[model samples]
Target: MEPVNDIAQLVVNGLMSGAILAVPAIAFSLIFAVLQVSNFSVAAHIALGAYAAYVVNTVLGLPIVAAVAIAFVAAGVVGVASDHLALKPLRRHGPITVAIASMALNLVLENMLRFGFGNTVQALNIPVYRDWVLGGLHIAPQQFYNFLIAAAVMVALFCLLAFTSIGKAMRAVADNPVLADIKGIDPEFISRLAVFIGMGLAGIGGVLIALDAAIEPTVGFRVILPIFAAAVLGGLGNVAGAVAGALLVGVAEELSLLVLPVAYRSAIGFFAIIIALLFFPRGILGKR
Candidate 1:
């Protein structure tokens, strides 16, 4: 491939990765917006999903798709469980209290995985689909599929939030939990649903990451920063912001390779978030 073609490929790959990150970024924003609490233990759920995929694929010899599906379901369960056990108890407290609880939950869950999985990196072996190259741009089937999947999912989410009563209730609760409750909305139920969607999306992100890279005990920790940065850059409670932010972060991270070491690519998200906040303050969309 020509140099220009290589750069194009890199850009495309970055966009694909960005879309994957957006999945969880949107989820994170949704939960935080609705519950007014940031679930720091979201990292744990990501790890759980990846590890679950590893187990099902490596141990049970299941297909990667099936394993990922199972992992998503499990992550949803864990999200609901965490809300019920760790977060619900602290709901009356300020958002800071829930954030702290999330941090604690993060530690507990990470330690548990370390104990059970032995602090090693596990690779998920998935068969590759055919790749297509056009006009010097290389398009891996999986990466293209990822982009399609993410885009479709985002569209579905938008439609759901726009047209569904539950979606309206969730948005109402997010805007004002107290008023929502008085208006007959169940804050607890909304919170649970938010958790379910957020963590499930996080799990999907994990599955994508695992598909692209090795699953390590520390993998979730490594990804949390970038994903969080994307969420913040997009706007704390805004789905559109999350998608935009994820793409921006992804492109920045990839293009940074021109002058900076590859290791610093991950830091682009933080820098971008800081800069975006410095300028927009309320975020790009000013949702919250």
Candidate 2:
């Protein structure tokens, strides 16, 4: 009974952690799918989202939902601006150039955040901190909410990709931008839209993470490694794959606690990334 309970608890915690990771993982996958660039600025966007939500929720005394919404919109705008101002110009320069530019953008955003918000850790002041216990499992309210929200967002994204015209256009562009342009699909518009949605998801993820733990300027950099591992393990350009990869990594990280020191938990993700790259370069779900 004790072993069963412990296993169940670990699984629960893994799922919750995976839920939180799914958003950023999906964001990374989306940008990679369309642009073929890692968009290192994603980390900065996430940190900015958390700080934006913090200001709205703490300084302005707004509700958590409102703060999250503001963060989403703000991040989306930033993403669009990034594409237009930074990545768009490097379109003819190749993927490596674009990636380098994105890294520079990330540095700028990180410094801006540090300058504006300082280096101190901050947390969201949401009113719900209670946990829900079912049988032998304990789940925090925010954890449960995060799972539901992540699931819903994934579903919505699938629907958008499956049923909407814009989604088809995006897919077409992803497969072959030159061909998509020949077919009258605007690659530039699709790219901007993809960035907007991707960063919006990142924003939501940032807010949820801040709700669960304290956040600082460096929080973005800290989580980017795991998020990248999940993306790579799942498949760089596959959104569904990213979610599955995130779950696997999350579970692996949590279960590692049973045998490894807590400080080494992050090592699990790095190990997974290394192994996956060696054996399955395309990832678990990536196309061969």
* Whole-model Cα lDDT of every candidate shown, in order: 0.83, 0.87
RMSD of 2: 1.5
How many clashing residue pairs are found in candidate 2? 0
The segments of candidate 2 whose C-alpha lies over 4 angstroms from its true place after superposition are: none
Summarize candidate 1's per-residue lDDT along 24-68 as a digit string, tens digits: 888788898887777778888888888888888888899877876
Q: Give the TM-score of candidate 2.
A: 0.95
TM-score for candidate 1, residues paired by index: 0.92
The top-ranked prediction according to TM-score is: 2
TM-score of each: 0.92, 0.95
Which predicted model would earn the best lDDT? 2
